[model samples]
Target: MQVTIHEQLVDVVLFIGARRRAAEAKGRHEEVKLWRYVWLLDDFVRVTGQVYRFEDSLRRELSAERPSISTHLGDHEGTLAQPVMDLLLETLDETPEPEQKQHVRVLIALVNFLAETGQLDEADGFVVNRWDYAPVAIAHFSNPEEAQAWMKSVAEPPSPVRILIGDEYFQFWYMREDNTRGMYRDYPIEPDLEWLTARGIPPETPSFATRVEAEAWLKSHPAHPYTFVAIAGEHYFAVHHPWLKRHSLHHVASTLEAWEERKRLVELDTDQETEDPSEGAGE
Candidate 1:
């Protein structure tokens, strides 16, 4: 009987040699299976947020296949223990030329793993409410300068999600826990950006910065309501869109705006413009 393996994990297993060693070292002992994980820095930080769950998933998978065996996980939080980090350090530490080349060759496996897991093209993030439009947030930066300030302020955090206007336009700066930088989205701009900017929604009275303050204001207004809550950093901003019929009304509105703009452009390009006969050069 052949053992089942997930394509995403194949390259990782090959490089780390943890799984290989376990199978070879205890070929005779039917009591344990071992696995070595190779995490990219960003992945390490993101997964670390849910570390307990990730660790459990791996252990569970190993146990299910080799039911009679126990599994193990390593505590390698800092960069020193990670494979790529170790590889870098090894190159710095005077690892043998042959072994170093071997490790470099093994990196091709990482590419295969990334492709299999859909990381190459990134995951398809669709609307939570499929019937409605996609999620959109217009983060106000008070002054234009504040845009720079806010972006700079949210510079470092673990897996900080970012909002990009378009793919090539502006890569909104975001950081990991250690303040490492990364881009959140890579969507197309020019045309696609209309999906996020449709009818505008203003803050509910714009009284306070926090959610609690907005909730208090809502009690007296009786009409103003919050559309979305952004729990990004130290503060959770409650965006109150008084014009929205429902909380998600903007989702559909935003989508319609993009569709309309694209359609209008198509019509303008296809229609033939009437030429003025005598007004060419002497008009």
Candidate 2:
């Protein structure tokens, strides 16, 4: 029942190739070009898997020879080959696992292909759904000290911590808190801003000004057993709690309101499950 990385790679390659073939059949030249690059990258990964320390040589080869190859192939638009080659090199530096690195390579190739073909929405979706390059977690801490300790442990960083509170996740390098940015999602039941306001958080507080500020806030609210989740980053860790779930932080928020809303939803679901069916039937 266990699927090997090679098998997964083959599946991805076949899926992309099938799409490319379909596009070719329909004369969808743009899509065909995109999928072709993805398919080629998959093949490249498989071929290069046997070679240890091939990345540098491969990068040099691409830099020296890809231009000529593209020119000879008449890829005037740079759509057919260059993007995938560039992405393969770029992703190589980001991941240590050879197989995961290949996955990233193909994912980025597909992203570039979709973007170039004007499928912006699809490209965005692919980034969110298909790409699993970053580490993710949902954490719970009993007290501010625990949260602070957890934060201190992960402070030696590179990538930003992406925290999702309600329907939005904010990205901030825990070391450089001034550069935080975020996006909102439209959930069926909106997060409770009033509850957050009561807790002294501004309704429009977009992000923490610094890691110090974030830690200070956590320290200040010692009694609240809050939910913390990391959506994307290289190093991720958290304190465990019974209520905390380890699922991907696919729907997250950085605000107290969002966390409260999620808690409320869980409570509501639990309450419904425990309700007496016989009493309801009489009503």
Candidate 3:
């Protein structure tokens, strides 16, 4: 027996539009403006349910004719707009079945868009007004507990530990503690010591059966932000140091090579200064 919010919105829209038409027929210019404002407010609520602020630049521009309506309706005494809004609130409180069903169709389309975009997490949170209108609708879920769990996961995700096997037939493992979880790609390429240095990973390391153990070890050393363990045949290398994890192994290798080249150039310059005693003596 309960009418939906969409039905109520449809009724309000039709009612306001009818009032506007009637005012137009009677040549009641002030009343026409009032009904037009009501129509705009009703449409805004039905669609977005956001507050209709008078000070909004776009809203102010759209409703620029309100001043003329206000002057004609003798709103200088402050008796016009508030009373109309109160009447609207009262009407919305007791929503009846809409004579026209267009608003219901609009509501359906909006709901479908929200659902398709995965934003329908809290349907009831969509309120009509800052005052007394009821929430638009309650989001229906088959398993509410499951839905809650999913929301929780979205809010705070578990950490991920990646195990990568390189082309040089070495196993490399790293753990990042954050929302990202699950294993990533298998990098079938060998990472040399220079690649490890560029990533700020230690040249030596220890082996762990699980990522949990590696995370614990990494966390224990706060000084070393990033740590990785690599196993090549019978040998294992464990290192604890700082590194940027988001870069690919190839990229890190190239970056480190460039850095090393710069360093060598600087060192060569320093060596040239030390070797040429005659240059400084003349100066």
- Backbone collision count in every prediction? 6, 6, 10
Residue 177 of candidate 1: its Cα lDDT? 25
How many residue pairs in model 1 have overlapping backbones? 6
Model 3 lDDT tens row, 106-218: 32333333333333332222222222221111122234354344334543322111222221111212122233333323222223445555466544555566544544654
**In lDDT terms, which candidate is top?**
2
Which residue pairs come into collision in candidate 3?
A: 166-189, 167-188, 167-189, 202-239, 204-238, 204-239, 205-237, 205-238, 205-239, 206-238
Q: How do all models score by TM-score? A: 0.24, 0.23, 0.23
How high a TM-score does candidate 3 get? 0.23
Runs in model 1 with CA error above 4 Å? 1-73, 76-145, 152-161, 164-170, 173-249, 259-283
The lDDT per prediction is 0.34, 0.41, 0.38
Query: What RMSD does each model have against the real structure?
Result: 16.8, 20.0, 24.3
Name the lDDT of candidate 3: 0.38
Model 1 per-residue lDDT at 159: 27
Q: What is the alpha-carbon lDDT of model 2 when measured against the actual structure?
A: 0.41
Pairing residues by index, what is the TM-score of model 1?
0.24
Error of 3 at 153 (Å): 8.6
